[model samples]
Structures are given as C-alpha cells and as structure tokens.
Target: MERRKFLKDVLKAGVGVTAGLTVGSALSFASQGKIELPLPYVKLDPKKVADRAYDGYYEHECAYGVFNAVIGELQRKVGGPYLGIPTLMFWYGGGGAAGWGTLCGTLNAAGAIFNLTCKQKDFKAMIDTLYEWYQTTPLPTYIPCKGNWCKQPFPKGVSHSPLCHVSVQRWCKNASVYFGRPILYNSKERSERCARLSATVAAKVVEMLNDYHFGNFKPHKVKGSQKTKMDCRLCHEVTMKELS
Candidate 1:
C-alpha cells in the first residue's frame, strides 16, 4: 500500500480497536507497523517554529486593550494562524495560573506549533526541539500573589494558597524534566538568554502559523478600556514585589 493509504488504514483500525487499547498503546502499535501519524505544523522545521512562537508573543497576557493594533498587523504582515482558544488557554493556564511562568508559555507555545507540523518521521525531532528550546530559555520572574492582571486572586479568606504555589512548582518541575536540564532562575545572564530565546521561538511560531494554511479565525480581543501597551516589565515587576 502507498504510505498515505497505509496510514489511513492503520488509523481506521486503531479507532475500531480503541475499546481494547489505550490511545498511546494503539499509537505505539501503529508505529511498530510503520504507519504514519499526523503532526502539527510548527514542529515541521525552524521556520514553522518561528511562526508559532510569534503568535504566542502577540497574544501574551490577554492584552485585549491593544488587540486591534497588534492582531491586524500580525495577520496582515505576519500572516499566520490567528491565535485561538486552545493557544490562549494553554498560555493562560500554564503561563498565568499553572505557575510555570514564561517557561510554560514557551513550552505550550511549542506544543501548539508541534501539532501543526507533526508527521510520523518528525516526532523525535519535535520532542528534541522542544527540549532544546527550553534548555536555552529557562524561567522568568515569578510572582506568588495575585496583584497583577495576569494572575488570579489568592483564594478567598486565605492569606496564602498552597494550591497555587504547588501548581507553579509542578510546572517548573515538569519543564526541567522535559528539557533534561535544571531550571534557571532569573539572573543577568539567564534573563538575557531567556529573552533572546523567547524572541527566537516566537518568531519561528509566527512563521509556521502563517504557513500552515489554516483558515483565519477572528482574534478575540481582550475586553477592557485601558489604552496602554502591556509588557513583561509591568507584570513581572509588580508581581515580584507583591510576592516579596
């Protein structure tokens, strides 16, 4: 059978047998049989990587105040997959409340990209690239309290919430394992390295989002009347102080 036909047959059979086999197990069986699997667009290569990352950067912090200014420019000029709920949720959950800080955002962003360029042959490369990217980017400034717009308020009547703290710690631990390296805390060298790494990844993601040929989805601008640009400086600075 042709490669595509063989893959289709395997997928159909996998679906039929799902009752008896876990998804991962079915996939593993398919893999051993030489059946191909789909992959996300951004995981395809360096170009796609740049595109997806860019989309994440543009949508950072749910900054709806400046959505019109940024979204149109990104769509028209950057010309990639418009940010969607899955992408936003990943960032908000992992980057915002999940407590991974910037590291989660970066990894989640990479995962989104991975979904795009995924192919059976590319799985190893995709996993490796994700780890490689994380090893270079490291962690960013973290705030334990909820004073900033990006974070949720501490649970009602509690001075401190162990759940929130635990969540962030878990994210960091997972990230370190994914990258196979110790997580880097904010420092002069590490900070600069993370900033540069983020920019590089963001640029790659944007390119992939555009190149994948996915239909355009309307950008969901954040709801607010504020007329200011949101930046890392505002969020990190204030939140760090609150945590301290």
Candidate 2:
C-alpha cells in the first residue's frame, strides 16, 4: 500500500500514521506472512513521555501539538524518524481534519506516532483505547504549570463521536460556554483543552508501545470503533424478540 493510504487507513481505523522518510533504522514486522518495514522508534517511559508531549501541546496546537510533543521526547535521547518532518504542515488537522472537522487532530497525531514506531497490529489495541478514552473521558486533562487557565475549571464532557466538530460541540454543551460566542472554533480555552488532550494521547501511546515492547499490552475487545454506526455493525445479525 502507498504511504498516504497506509497512514489514512491506519489512522481512520485508529492511526497516520505520519508519512515521511526516516533517518533511523527501520524495523520490520511480520504481517500476514509478509515482511514489512516501518518507521523507527526507541523504548520510553509512558507517563514521562506523555508529560513531555503535554508540554509541547502548549508550544504548538493540535496536530503540531502532539506531533511536537512526541518528537520532542524522541529527539532528547534518540533521533531518526523525526529528523526531517515539517512542523507547521499538519496543523491543518485543526477543527477536525484540516479545518474540515473530520477526525480529531490529536488522534491524527497519535496515528502518526504508531505508524512511525509500531506495527499495524498494534494500532487497533493502542489507538482503539486512545479513541475510546477520548470519546468517554473529560478532555483538557492536562493543565499548564503556568497559566490562568491552569486554575480555571475545565468542564467534563464525553463526545459520542470523534469528529472535531462534535467533540468540541459536546464540550461546549457540557461547559455551557459556546452557546453564544463571537467565534467558536478559536479560543484560549479550547486550545488549552486540546493541548492537554494531545499530551494525554501521546502519553497513552507511549505506554501502550512500551507494553507492546514488554509483552504486557492488551488490545480492547470492543469492535466497530470510531465510526458512525460502524459499517461492520451494519451487517450484524440480530436475535428475534418476543412478539405479540
């Protein structure tokens, strides 16, 4: 498969999988009896790595936020897959996908990391957990050490879906903040939330990957993920109920 297609497929299903060339040694994994090469990565502490990513979110925004966050962590001790990546390129994922509001950019960033550092099989396990966590959990979980928003109350809300529009909308509803506003998409509050979210995601991914390396990782048993009534579920058979 082509790189972009692979990235999209993995990410939409839970990943990018960031698409780019790497300077580090590529690791190959067996998939369906075929040997495939993937992006390079080194082992890391999950929470510490995530904390690093959270800090990066404040430096950049969603796409770049998590991207920079993970990259920063990687570059500190190891350097290869991220040598030539463009920093500002992926910010387009903001407000869904590139201003289109499709998938959350933070999710996009997570996908990129998996594609670069892990196997395809790992995507579902780690990415699925990440997506589920995002959907069911309260966001902006990370707070800046220095900022007024740090003390401000970050409302809790669950986005039934992962679309940026719906995620932001759900948060707005729960917080009761976006009902009437001059601008809804851009705000310090929202940015702060996404940053925290980005950090949370990166941290989760790091832990998942570490578990995979250590053979302790577990994939979720739930099926049909991050979809609008999953296509797979469409064909699911149902048992008959009692009838009058």
User: Against the hidden true structure, what lDDT does model 1 obtain?
Assistant: 0.37
Best by TM-score: 2
| Poorest 10 consecutive residues by lDDT, candidate 2 | 22-31
lDDT of 2 by residue, 1-244 (tens): 2744554455554422323332232233222333243555666776676666666666656777777666666654454335556655667766577678788888888777766677776665666777777777766665556567667666656776667777877676666554344324466656666767777777767777667766677767346635433223223464344110
lDDT of 1 at 86: 31
lDDT, residue 198, candidate 2: 75
**RMSD (CA, angstroms), candidate 2:** 10.7
On a 0 to 1 TM-score scale, where does candidate 1 land against the true structure? Answer: 0.31
Error of 1 at 24 (Å): 30
Question: What TM-score does prediction 2 earn?
Answer: 0.68
lDDT of each: 0.37, 0.63
